[model samples]
Target chain A: MLTPLKEFATDIRIQQMEEFKARGFGHVGGSLSITDCLAALYGGIMRIDPKNPNWEDRDRLVVSKGHSGPALYAALALKGYFPLETLKTLNQNGTTLPSHCDRNLTPGVDMTTGSLGQGASTACGMALGLKLSGKDSRVYLILGDGECQEGQVWEMALFAAQHKLGNFIAFLDYNKRQLDGYVTDICDLEDPAAKFESFNWYVKRIKGDDPDKIYETILETQKNQKDRPAMIVLDTVKGGGVKQIEDTTLNHHLNMTTELADEIIKQLIKQKEG
Target chain B: MFKCIYNGEKETKAGKTVFGETIRKMIEEDPQVVYLDADLMNSIGTSGLEKSFPNQVIEVGIQEANMAGLSGGLSAVGKKPFMHTFASFAGRRCYDQVFISIAYAKNNVRVIGSDPGITSAYNGGTHMPFEDICLYRAIPHSTVIEFTDSAMTAALLPVIKERPGLTYCRLSRKNCIAIYSEDSVFEPGVANILRDGKDAVIFACGYMVSESLKAAETLEKEGISTAVVDMFTIKPLDTAKVLEFAEKTGAVVTAENGNVVGGLGAAVAGFLSETRPTPVIRVGVKDEFGQVGTPEYLAGVYGLTPADVVAAVKKSISLKK
Candidate 1:
């Protein structure tokens, strides 16, 4: 049988590419980089019921790297949080789908997260709350490699470790690209897995777009972690599906026009038909 | 050393004789009341209550943000959570969480901020939240109240419980003078206008209530008949009463232990500027860092005392002239 999760993620990546193509210009780099991680979470591993967004026992998923909200929106639509048709209204005025997910407005999003480091801290609070109430529910937070530069992220790492919130798992989408330039040029976040591990978290590094690897690590995280939070250094490629954009020096959030949209849609149709 | 003091009396009871004492007492008589503390069981009068009713008391430990979220979670599952912590940390330290988790969700969570304002005493500036009630009142759907005495707190405990929306009770660590009689019941959203006059209204809350009363007496003897109103609920402020007093007097003097910028003065000024538009003078700690002192001395140094109120009235009157 075909792998449902891998196929589904590939489907969402195609959608992610198409949506940006429609916007002509959007957070293409970060969105493309985080698409597969979102797929791995919503498709294969995370236990969430889209119907009951406020379900007391449902697992929570927070996109800490909120600038890549297009990727998360793609996942939410495919998971039936809202109709996939409604996704075309993304970033439009009065649309519930903002550039960054607002938990108050959106259905599936667990917390409103636009500020770089605050989402990680907020997700940590949710995990801590779950543990306090003795709930077995888990929290999956995906952060951007560039966003890791925020000091509050490390503070949360230390807090989660100290609290023994083993139910918490955060994936760092290390696409090496930020708003202005490459992370190496800006300030190299060298060895994020080691940094989190040293901070007493059970952590691992993996190629982020490989849904199989990402999903496996997520499950392994829950099994092995007796105490302390877990961190996954998700090695991703900026603009991964759009081969022209991945790991490019100027790559971060790219804004394209109608012509670029037509060209990208052509490539996506080819990828899907094959 | 459970022998804490409130209203000049040694705080020893069923061991729950502090702010949470009345609630703990309610817990025994009524099964609906429960206590949730963020590792601050000793501070707000739940340290011993937990020992007696293990199932009823929840200790979320030193995480205020998490404690706030858990209060929402617990309340969602049908348990009333009276989350307690110091005024600053619980109110300001995690404002967003309290707004979202408890207030936005419309959960039955009462945030009791103990050691409010300078009552943190030797705990220094970090522990002392000089602007808690302002933060509490800022969030939408928040019902903020500061008790003047142990008697008021004892009366208001049941009042706060019967209502279901979000509420913040600012509690002081020091023993304040019991102002209201034992039978007095505080009406929410209603200002208790004590002594009325055609002069300026002395608006205050919490410890400032007693200090304002003292100031009123002193100002009265000085031939200035000042009207004093206990504006305990900072949010849903009795603007009608404040404006009537402001318009009749044509001058205003607000006293609180908070920064004058956001506390009573701002509320009164915002109202009057829109409707009455009177010459108002604010008497609070002038914009500066607060320090450790007795609640009385701190009130005096910060210009929340009756003498300061009298001075503020004189200045406001001069502006009217």
Candidate 2:
């Protein structure tokens, strides 16, 4: 199980890198950082039907930091939501895969979100709606640590806790970097886990790069969620798994020439084979 | 199917009360209909709705942005959400949320903004929103409706729910001058001609609809024939009716309780300028912030009374070629 999940994460990274290569420039850092969690969710954890993307009983995922749409598109395509070949058209003229997550254009994308912190609120709405209807399907929200600077995120945090949305699980990608600089330098989140806990949420912090940990935390929290929404703070590296991009500081968005993309892909293949 | 039954009297039930009743009925009939309020439930007379339908009513504190995004999420999951707040918060405060989450994202939701324009009364400048119509009108493929009376308010709530896309309903919380009978059904994008005349037409909505009628009455007594039109659905501006009146009368005056820059006045003038170059005068507030005052006092201050409409109508007629 762990090996297959790791392979899924590796494939997502490779596919997303190729998609970014097609665009020549894209949001690489944020997208790379959340690949493991996306792999775990789409690969095994989430109960979604690739055939029927709009099935009412399916679990929903809302990515608040929507600039990392390539990561989601890669996962969706690998899971057969759409043909993987469609990834070549990322952000091209009239492409279904936009630079940001849009539900209208993409299948398997639960909610449209681009303006930061909005997905948190929408996720809570979905959780509450499911709770009201007595449907046990869970809603998973992926938020950027830097995006937490938006006041709307905390507003949703307060709301989710107050409503006791046990079916909602939020994963905050604490990659320590945003567009301008490190999140601490820009606007320190101080202690996000403590903040959510103070807001009455059950909180946990975990190393985000491991798919095994990511998959296990979700299953554990699913059992222990007693009237409180769960918040899993992912301690991750910006531009994780790619040494070339990880070595670069300003990697939130990068200009990746085709040659550079080939070199990185070769390095990734070498690591996978070895 | 639209008809006018204005008899020169106030509506027995306030617009908010009628809205509350309609919301109650919608929830009772449909299990998917959910009503969300931003701590203004009592202000909009929906405070008691939660008691009867607790699962359907959500008071989302005072966070308008959250309320807007939450409604989009609700709509995505097949719950028809109707969010209400002051016009200030509903239109300006959470403009981006409504635009991106609900309208641009193609989420099915209905947003009700209470106390539009001078109807906000003592809530002062911060509470008054003279630009909500303009804000909502700019969104791509959005329905903007301004409720003129209790009958219209009651009649249109269900229609808005069944409509396919995003909708913004600007309403008054208090009583309005009666403009339609209880049985009068309304379809959006159609004009309700209250009084017809060939001399000139007064296009109005909200508080100005009754004021325009009064102005038309005064114009009729002076042997100058004038028409009064309740242009309730402002966005898809009854272009057919506007063209008919503009061609027949060769003169037009728009009256609104809000600013002339982007309200009914702007819609009418902008359309006529492109379609047919006719004489048009806007009777509304001109780039001014609201202040704490009675609706009547503010109308006097902002020149929104019948006399003002009458003056604008004469000015429009004088400019006609």
Candidate 3:
């Protein structure tokens, strides 16, 4: 039986497929891999006002793995941040939706992120600012496993720990694949949970595709009394949920022909109806 | 119409102290103002600020790029962030963060890069940055300024704080010759004509402004009149003031404590070649690296004294037809 949040995730995944099919090319593997976590965040976990996207006390979400913008946009649209019909305009001329997340163009985007490791540092600043101002707002950040190769990520990890940013919670989308190839073949980040734990972040490794587990973990982490930041290493598969693309080894980005896109959309619609 | 009044003292106040005092005052006045440094609070004299406003001042130990992204993040949430670090690390070590996180994202951040150019004397070539101005000038909508002295540093702080977008402030940590009075007023993108003459005009910025003034006095003794313009703001270039002075003097000399290739010299020459074709001679480091030495020893070694400026002025005058 699908929980309400899992059903929401499935609808978002279908919308993401429709978006990529309309565009004919998009980052498919990584985008699909993180959809459930995005659904959990937008649906139940984050304290946000869809009508007032820039609410001062709203919990902030910065998708540091910004290439997964398609999934994020679907979640935002389904949450009524903007009209769901606008998702078809992804990457088109004069479209507000670009390939990567842009805070200026997107209504619900908290931080503009595309360059691998920059969003993590920005999230730290936001958390620090909120804490200094005596605001109870929390900040959530998402990062990719391959994005951890950037030295700036470690630099931010050190900073976040030293400052005791308890209001900051980061999710590492451990999708195991990058633009080049498998993460282990390129630059393995084995024991990522231990790596973050060594940096003084309270680490929680969870199955990313399970909406109930993601929501419960976020709640439990937020309840902890630790005076340090938290990191949830989400064990996800690249191109998860869909079997055909998930089986492909190098499905980071896809050049979707008419036939391939139609087949994916058919599967998505059937799953949605079921 | 700003005038420069030399106080005749070799030192008035250190730029870092003035920056520290001004930033401390800003933090006290505005709750929205936050300070970040790469563990150089003592180096830049901002340790006192950390003591008083512990929550507002963040000392990210030895992390320049992370500090920049942190500034961007703070700016995203409507907090005005001021970051300080050495020029070399601030520019070269964290150029990408300043480019994407701050400038490209259109977030407001004020970066203070202390000990610019030859002012990093005892710190050696590893710490000196001659290419900072070149790197910062490439960012669109970035306001880049080189502080001439303590007075200018104090005057420009509030102005830069209120302005939006990315602002880079290049200042020296130590004291230099005082060029402006304590009450001297300044406007962004406006060059100060310290002295007016007809023979030629010398465009100078940062530590080179004092050298230009001394060179003007030397030329006056030799019966050759010269005009001196303090071109403090580098990016916007103050092309109108440059063109007006270049047209009036008919010859130009650019003096800077940085490289002649892409510093103030290149900016002035590039503008003049397009607007007014004037004979411009650049008096600065001639495509070389820095070494550990005293300020005096380094000035002489790099030909950055008033004699070099005077020689360049005379040569430019001779080249003018």
Candidate 4:
């Protein structure tokens, strides 16, 4: 299970780079940071049907930090929601795969979220609605640590706890960097896990790039949090894989040539094989 | 089958209470219909409903932005969520969320923004929303409906619930002049002609609908026959009806309880300027912020009165070529 999940993460990263290469420039850092978490969910946790994307009882996911749409589109492609070839159409003219996650445009995206701090509240509403309708399907949300600067995120944190949305789960990609600079310099999110804890959410901190840990933490939370929402904070690098991108200071969104993409894909393949 | 019962008296029930009752019926009938409030249930006359439908009625405290996005999320999951808050917060404070999360996302949700304009008389500048109509109308594929009275509030609840995209329902929480009977069935994007005339036409919505009717009566006594139209749907501004009346009358007066810049007056003027150019006089708040005062005092300060409408009608008629 761990080997397949690791390979899934690697494939998502490679395809994400390929899509970015097609688009000339894309949100590279934020998209790569969450690739492993996306792989774990689409591989192990989320209950979704690629053929029936709108299944009423299917578990839903909202990418709150919507700039990471390339990674999500890649995961959806690998999960059979769409063809892998469709990923080349990212941000192109008259394409379904937009730069931001739009539920109407994408097949598996549960909520449309581009503006920060909104998808957090919407995920709570979806969880609450599912609980009200006596459905066991869960709602998973992926938020950026920089996105936490938005007051709406704290508002929803309080709301989800108050509502006792046990079916709601969120992951904060604490990649430590944002568009402008390091999150610590740009309005630091001091002690985010403590913030969620004080807000009464069941909180956990885990290594973000490890697909095994990501899958296990989600399973544990889903079992324990029957009366409270859980917030799993992912401790991650701004650009986790591909040493060339990770070593850079400002890699949030950057130009990725097809040659650079091919080089990164070769490294990923060699690492996976070894 | 639109009937006007403009009897120059206030409705027995407040607009907020009628709205509460209408939603109560919807909640009772459909399990999927959920009511969400930003801790203003009592203000909007929807208090104590949580006891009957605990799962269906949710109180999201005072986070208006959260409530807006949450409503979008609920709609995405097939729940017909009706979110309520002051017009100022519902539109201005949470405008981006409504624009991106709900409207842009194509989520099926209804937002009820109460106490528009001078209706938030005592609540003052902080609570008043003069540009809510403008804010909502600016969103593409969005419905902006203002309730003229209790009957209109009750009648439009069901209609807006089934609307495909985002729908903004603006209404007053307190008593409004009774204009429509209980049996009046209104279709969206159609103008409700209250009184017919050939000299000029007065287009109005919300509390000003009654004022327009009263102005029509006063104009008739002074020998000027003015047509009164309750232009409730502000976004898809009843183009055919507006063109028909502008061609028939050649003079137009727009009355609203909001700022003339982006409210019903602007909609009517912008439409008439492009399609059928006519002499249009706007009777509304003259681009000023609301202040703490009584409803009557605020109306006088902003020139939102039947006398104002009458004067505007006369001016429009005199300006007609």
Cα lDDT of model 1 overall? 0.75
State each model's CA lDDT, in order. 0.75, 0.91, 0.90, 0.90
* CAPRI-style class, candidate 1: incorrect
Question: Per-candidate interface C-alpha RMSD?
Answer: 4.8, 0.7, 0.7, 0.6
Candidate achieving the largest DockQ? 4
lDDT of 2 at B63: 91
Candidate 3 structure lDDT? 0.90
DockQ for candidate 1, please give it.
0.15
Clashes of each: 7, 0, 0, 0
- Supply candidate 3's per-residue lDDT for B262: 80
Query: What tens-digit string does per-residue lDDT give for candidate 4 at A1-274?
Result: 2399999999999899889889889999999999989989999799999999999999999999998999999999999999999999999999999988999998998888889999998888899999999999999999999999999999999899998999999999999999999999989998999999999999999989898889999999989877999999999998897798999899998998888888998999887887
TM-score for each prediction?
A: 0.84, 0.99, 0.97, 0.99
Superposed Cα deviation of residue A170, candidate 4 (Å): 0.5
Model 1 lDDT tens row, A1-274 = 3266666776776666666655655787888887777777887687788898788888888787777788888888888889877777777778887787676677887776666766676677667656656788888888888888876677667677876888989989898878898899988898898899899999988988777778888888888987879998888888877777774567666776667666766776665566
lDDT of 3 by residue, A83-144 (tens): 98899999999887888999899889998899999999999999999998999999999999
Per-model TM-score of chain A alone?
Answer: 0.94, 0.98, 0.97, 0.98
True contacts kept of 1: 0.06
What is the two-chain DockQ of model 3? 0.82
DockQ class, candidate 2: high
